[model samples]
Target: MAAPVCLEYRIEGNDFMVAGAASNNIKNTLKMLGISSSVCTRVAIIAYEAEINLVIHGGGGVLKAEITEDRVKLTAEDEGPGIADIEKAMTEGFSTATEYAREMGFGAGMGLPNIKKNSDEFNIESEVGKGTRLYSTVFFNKQ
Candidate 1:
């Protein structure tokens, strides 16, 4: 395990073109840091999903990464019309994205599930009129 490293990224709302930039940068950083390939892959997937969610559902947000000896933590905070129904939003095929988002091939309603699947731990909080925040962690296994 290496020393703890912290990374942060700002996600622009409705920016489809740069939606995955933060995740890509994080992936590359992990690779350069010599993290395990499997770990990096999982992180990349979760990060990408979370990033897209920020762009699609968040209106705009920020992503924070904290790397420790045992795990990597990623948190995304966005300021958008909060999710009206958390339960419905979690459904596989449920989506409230605008036509433009859908046209961009995003908002398939799989982002949250995918992030949860790839992370060791996941938590989400949202306020109807405020915004949403997601916290995810991927633990590093001692081989």
Candidate 2:
């Protein structure tokens, strides 16, 4: 088995110009590592979605990716004004994105759902004034 690898990135709030940089970098790294295409695809989708969410809703946050021979784990943690209703936030087409966010071609409100859909396991925890943390994992074998 290969040794585990961890990659981290900071997502700056209100940054539309550079959003998805982390996810794209991770995807490229996974590809260079020769991870299976299916697994890479899943991870890319989830990572991109989560990264964009952080940019739009997270105030500011970190994106972490831990990769092992058998799994890839993704975690996104943000500070301030966390989700008031996670359930509602998870619903498709329900977005809190601003007018500028829409102009950026985002705010379709599919980020969380897509993240969940692409993850083999997923969990989310949040507090209104504290923060939100999303944990998700995809098993290599699941592909």
Query: Which candidate ranks first by TM-score, i.e. highest?
Result: 2
For candidate 1, the per-residue lDDT at 19 reads 82
Residue pairs clashing in model 1 are 13-59
> What shift in Å separates residue 89 of candidate 2 from its native position after superposition?
0.7
lDDT (CA) for every model shown? 0.88, 0.91
TM-score of candidate 2 to 2 decimals:
0.95
Per-residue lDDT tens digits for candidate 1, residues 20-52, read: 999999999888878899999999999998888
Q: List TM-scores for all candidates, in order.
A: 0.94, 0.95
Q: In model 1, what lDDT does residue 35 have? A: 85
How many times do residue backbones clash in model 1?
1
Which regions of candidate 2 are displaced past 4 Å?
none
Residue range 28-143, candidate 2, lDDT tens digits: 98888888999899999999999998888887799999998889999999995898999999999999899999998999988899999999999999999999999999998622
Per-residue lDDT, model 2, residue 21, is 97
